[model samples]
Target: MITTPEHDERMAKMTFASVYPHYLTKVEKKGRSKEELHQVIEWLTGFDDKKLQDLINEKATFETFFQQARLHPNANLITGVICGYRIEDIETPLTRQVRYLDKLVDELAKGRKMEKIIRGQ
Candidate 1:
């Protein structure tokens, strides 16, 4: 895993004019949009203008942007496709809520299993 400091440093050195084409290439590969890219930045940095400017100005690395994007609420669908799982169309608010809730439950179950193993139970 790349450390956050290294990630930030690389991001700081990027120039968008040079990186935009590559960024668009990744977006095409992922079947996402420029809007999604902006949304990911907004989500990751709490919509900080300075941070957004830095990301845009530096031609941020796709790896860093992709990692940040995955933290967005819609990222589960992207991950599903990447992992060879079927992506569900969670268009409705209810469906979205349930999906997130299910993810939360799964995480809790994994935490419980980890705790048991750590405790030698």
Candidate 2:
């Protein structure tokens, strides 16, 4: 089981740009388009395509990346187990937000419908 500190350190060291290609690869491997991935991310994080690109270009860390995000009102609707920890149970707000994005991407990669993933129902 991953401890909070371990999760925090890992997230702190991760750059959104560095992880972007991997997200694309995960979704694309399942025949999902990058546009679709972006759409889900945009719906959840409130970052449009150009702004997301700018953030990616800046090589923002997961902490900085999420700090800039204007999370959707429906974001709290996203709650479930992701990587063993319940998304709603993560104690650190920043860490929880990071895991929320990770969980959303994982759901998308697992072939979940976009609307449900975004709406969380």
What is each predicted model's overall lDDT from 0 to 1? 0.40, 0.85
Give the best candidate by lDDT: 2
Residue 34 alpha-carbon offset, candidate 2, angstroms: 0.3
lDDT of 2 by residue, 22-76 (tens): 8899999998999989988898788999999998889999888888898888888
TM-score of decoy 1: 0.30
Model 2 regions lying over 4 Å from their true place: 1-3
**lDDT (tens digit, per residue) of candidate 1 on 22-42:** 545565565565554444344
Candidate 1 residue pairs that clash = 14-58, 15-58, 16-59
Error of 1 at 39 (Å): 1.1
Q: What is the TM-score of each candidate against the true structure?
A: 0.30, 0.89
The per-prediction CA RMSD against the true structure, in angstroms, equals 15.3, 2.1
Model 2 TM: 0.89
Error of 2 at 121 (Å): 10
